[model samples]
Target: MTRPRYGDLYFGLSDSRNEANQDRDSFLQTYVDLNGSTKRVVRGDKFLVLGPKGTGKSALAWYLQFAEPEGAHLALVRDASSLPLAEVPRLQTGQEPGPERTVVAWKFILLCNYLELLMRDQGCSINRNPEVVRVARLLRDFGFMGDASGRALLKFSTTTVTIPVPKLGTIYKRESSSALNIFNLIPYLEMWVAEAESAVRHILLIDGLDSIFLNDAKYDESLSSLVQAAYTLNQKLMENRATGSVVLLLRNDIFSRIALSLPDSQKMRDDLALELDWRVLSGKAGVGAPLMRLVNTKAGRALGVDNFEVLKYFPDSIEVGSRELGVRKIPTFQYLLNMTRHTPRDMLRLFEEIRRVEASGIFEESGDRLRQEVIHEGVLQYSTKYFVGAISNEFAGYAGGPERAAAALTALKAINKQSFDGDEFRESLASVASGIEVDHRDLLRLLFYAGAIGNSIGGYREKSYMQFYHRRDESEIYLQGNFMLHNALIHAWGLRRTLGNEPESQTGAIPLIDRGAARPRRRRRKWEERKK
Candidate 1:
């Protein structure tokens, strides 16, 4: 059999870092947890992994579910956008269930999934286990599949309980005499866990909660329940030792929304939750070195090697401009990362695009040695262009669907400026008649959060950067600064970035991307010119 060439091997690259392809091998081979903090956190009993979209929330969940640590049985739950959670009782009497009862519902739902897993593992029919059967039946009544595998349970928990759950204060007194035996699934789960203790510890990895807990008011109450559930369930499992754990992988934006009204919000944020961040700067370095390491790992896998030094595949620096124009050298990874919003998924997609572009044989290819290959300028440009489009798609859901967000990007590109003041941005925004109907302020906030732009404050000397996820609790920060779109977007947007102490006004003077520039007007013919 003939061995595959480097170009053919690059075909395994995934375009997007989503869990849409749940192949265990696909996940294990290239997965890298920046600092290993996320891995340690997930291995624990209870915790929440919070991050913005495309920061590897689902990827981590997929890792936990498929490549779980030793001595643990990881059960992944996904497709939460179709969950049937609305039927879960939000009200006990005439009052909505307090945080405790809300916690109970989450525990009950989690246990149902766990029991289903245990039943499937035992190969005994789900019907044989009365406890599991009862809980499954209850879930079925709420429009879920009683006999489905634990993974399929993700479909039934999409919508959350609305705030001020209607009839909470009214329906309670009428049902005050009710025996809550049916609602108590924890005890059954506890008994099952005790029996299974000698076997393996189980963990329920709940993913896609970001979609389930939309910031909309209707989801506030339901999201609160999940927060409380993490706290309460962990406490129970910690004490029992027989039970496994539950890890909720959610977006930081959604977590912030859920934490706002939750009483134990501080505990969750400061204690129980582990944030999956790629923006953390170490020592005095502003860039995410960890993300670079992550990219190296992916690159290593792509090259079919164990070495992960990125420079081996790409040059340490690239020289630009002619001798007359003062040629300068730039760090390769620094340039790549600066163009990115600093997310692992973004870097992965960028590298994947680079490989795809290289596959076209547009650049010179190296010999039998894999590490000798070089990703040329054309590949970088193509990848960056592809990344810009992916950014809009990544945040489209956050902007409340794709069409409007797509329009917003279209309008932004047409305005064609890299830096903007509040007044100037608003004026430019008004020129675009298409796209979403958001005000300039809201549009900026959305773009900042989506990583399309960054907030530049304190001017050149003490330049401080603020992203949408930065100071999430402070709403006032949105309207306070001059804005700069990311350098990664420079070419795609036909804009340029002027680094250092340059004034904002002078910054826009830099040359626009020639390829992205508007087509020039044709010279009129002599006869046609006479008519004019």
Candidate 2:
């Protein structure tokens, strides 16, 4: 039977990167360039991809791997906590959690080092080597490289082969020392890889970094170990010359947990890196450029769209508006366009949803009428769910429960908030959110991450404030980037009051708090004012 055409497959770019070779255009190449900043963020660097969920960090990493740019090798490691007991025995053993996790993670890297080596053209030559034999058998048995009920392992300690002297005859000896502890083996692995082929750089990427959950089960040992490994990895790279890079696709909250674990506060910053931030223009725009590059590649090639073909052509554009005002910001374009707003994820998600809806056969696949109706329904369905899901937490914080939180949403709404300020007007905050506890720097983050709210203004591009943003407007008001309940709380309270449940002292008839009650209005003066 013939294989399915590339167009016949799902648009789920995640984990389906193997299908990328078929599509060719799904590589996400548009966002490779840096913005005005001079930071070196190209693939294969010890960079951190830090942002709230769904910012497309994982997608970009996959794109880079597909591109195979110079010095670009990626590992994509899952955090050790996610490793099954079958994968790593150390997690099951009762011992000092920190040191054990660190050891296991290094061994994890060691496995990646082996895989990268084995996959390379030079590595396949040493296939007959004993070390390669041992390791391969282990991986196969562990199910990492084999089928279900893993019962195999490989025996490749370390091997490098090339057409040059000292390589074709001698293998790059694999050491058994855990670099997370010794901190010297990482350099050795680098040197070994270079020996195999000096021109090749393997990039080690660890996505799903947050999957490594820690608890009293081992007294957080697994996490401590991962953190230690990361620290050592960072130090080694900082001090030595770079042959490749290690990247982690991690959640901000995970990093926050890591920050609290570090013995030295400065080490956290030195070792911990972020790709997305809730801060200035430096945060989302910085990462958005590269991510959009990935989506453009995938959408154009997979869906046959023409606007953003190459990974690089997908230029970032954001929506900016005056909340209390409107402007005729017109531009000349020869082509008729249906203007809409999107972030990198929105572009990909839109494509994915479109593909799914069309293929689901919910409507008769008869003509343009069905397709148009589906598109309209799709947009509304996506928007309503996205808005409610995004603001649900903030709404809950304001209303003090999940029930009222559901009402904060509007059908197919767009981002329209005017500003974000971390300080100043914090006083106006209701006690609704006062009942909850959340991480710092995430007040605005809850809304931003859910892809519900955005900067009403600014960045590489702007969109509705209710829509997620790749950038922020500069002229908006300020609100804390903290875990804030949205302003809809007042309305919720009013509704509850009208239903006869609100406290009489706090309803519209009386102020919730009245300062200087001692001061009284004269009865005659009040009566005359009322009559007038």
Candidate 3:
């Protein structure tokens, strides 16, 4: 019957992968299902999960593999970091070390995993079925029976082995002159899986692809092959009437590059991919939006309350002003959401920062609610620590990428203006472009794609024409048009609110959040009042 303290409520972890690994129960407890992504995966309707960083792709994979839904299923979640991805091209597939060879290698490896799982099921026993015995022997011989890493398993690919089939002769006769490798066992493995049928469905979820990505030709080919292999294997399962599926988690940028070269790129994009985008229409993410609902779910579960109202934990609203929209009152949640790219991790990190500020006693709380001052201070800290670091890490794969991004931020700070023309922007970067290898044009493109800056789409008199990359896909930076800094990076870079050389009326003015305002009286819902 009492409100919970801000320190006592859990906002969930910043890294979903770590949470899924370390504390799965807590991770599942706080998870919020935005769309029907979980159902689509379970029903084998979708296999590819693609999204930008911090969009909860890993979390969705974890939930699909770990959650206990009302169905017969066997799920295996593999972390790609543990697999020997670099050694994939070395495996013998009778082809050059390219995407084609990688596809064959991935198919063999995936079938091997599925066979191991199928053989271990209670329905399958070596004593009952001779095929199970042969499969078990093959797995044990290949070092897959015990705790073997992918590198260890790949070592056995070159070994000569003879697998015999019933009624038929030996498939791969071991001989010094002509010997068959692991690729030759794919068909037999497929038969073993198809023949050993059970009521339970098998699902394999692969995560951590982004962690191992290097943004090079080899990685691009390797990743593309995995995707192709997964699609083909899923189709085979469906055709054979086998209850099995394979799902891959990938970053949107990586997928975009690989999809360009794929023959069936359109089909992959239109039919199989599930994009984990959480961005809502402007001014529409108030109370029940996906990201907001995620916060409420975590708070409710942590505080042991049903239908918990997260807005009660902070001030009602904050006043923000811009040249387009003159001074107006905005909800505290919308104000905070404006500073994020509409990702669950971003919201969680913002709340975590606020909790840290509250714990430091910099701003006193009023009746179990955080003061507006604490929220403001939290946004400032979050921008500098998490936002800047995330941007640098996003571009970490390119040559001198992190340095170039950092230099761009410094240049913006030196410019000390919120908006600038193309000439001013180039001149500002010229001052800081001492050792950076990237040119001014490339730097501008990088900043635009990274969502650090955007292009103005309309004329001077039009309002709300500013668009960022994260918000719209068609938003491009033009050398002749104006450029506005993203709202999320303004505080972090400490830029002034001036157009070219003219300062606005409210330049350097901080939004007035009610720090000493009295907490509003709580109103009981209709059902609660009826119960009373």
Q: What is the TM-score of each candidate against the true structure?
A: 0.73, 0.47, 0.80
Residue lDDT tens for model 1, 52-119: 66667676666665664532454545444445444343533222456565566666666666665555
lDDT top scorer: 3
Runs of candidate 3 with Cα error greater than 4 angstroms are 68-71, 81-90, 96-98, 124-178, 212-214, 319-329, 421-430, 459-464, 471-481, 499-532
Off by over 4 Å in 1: 1-23, 34-43, 68-72, 84-104, 123-142, 145-198, 211-213, 282-288, 301-305, 320-327, 366-385, 394-400, 434-436, 459-476, 496-532
Q: Count the backbone clashes (under 3 Å) in each candidate.
A: 13, 69, 0
User: Can you write out model 2's per-residue Cα lDDT over 311-341, one digit (the tens) per residue?
Assistant: 1211222122235443222111000011112
- Writing each residue's lDDT as its tens digit, candidate 3 over 1-532 gives 6776776677877777677788887777777776888778767887888876688888887776667454467677777767767667666665555667788888877776766666656664323566456655766676654446475547844643344443323342333333345566676667666656776777778887866544577677777888888888887777787766788888776777788768886798689888887664323434667777778888787666669877778877765556674765656776777677667788788888877887787677656567767877888899988887776666655667767777877787777878887778677787887766667777676676666776655422343245556523324457677777766678787766765422221111211111000111122133335667
Check candidate 3 and list the clashing pairs. Answer: none
Model 2 earns a TM-score of 0.47
Candidate 2 weakest lDDT stretch, 10 residues: 331-340
All candidates' lDDT scores? Answer: 0.53, 0.37, 0.67
Residue 1 lDDT in candidate 3? 69
- Could you say which candidate leads in TM-score? 3
Q: Rank the candidates by TM-score, best first.
A: 3, 1, 2
Rate residue 101 of model 3 by lDDT: 73
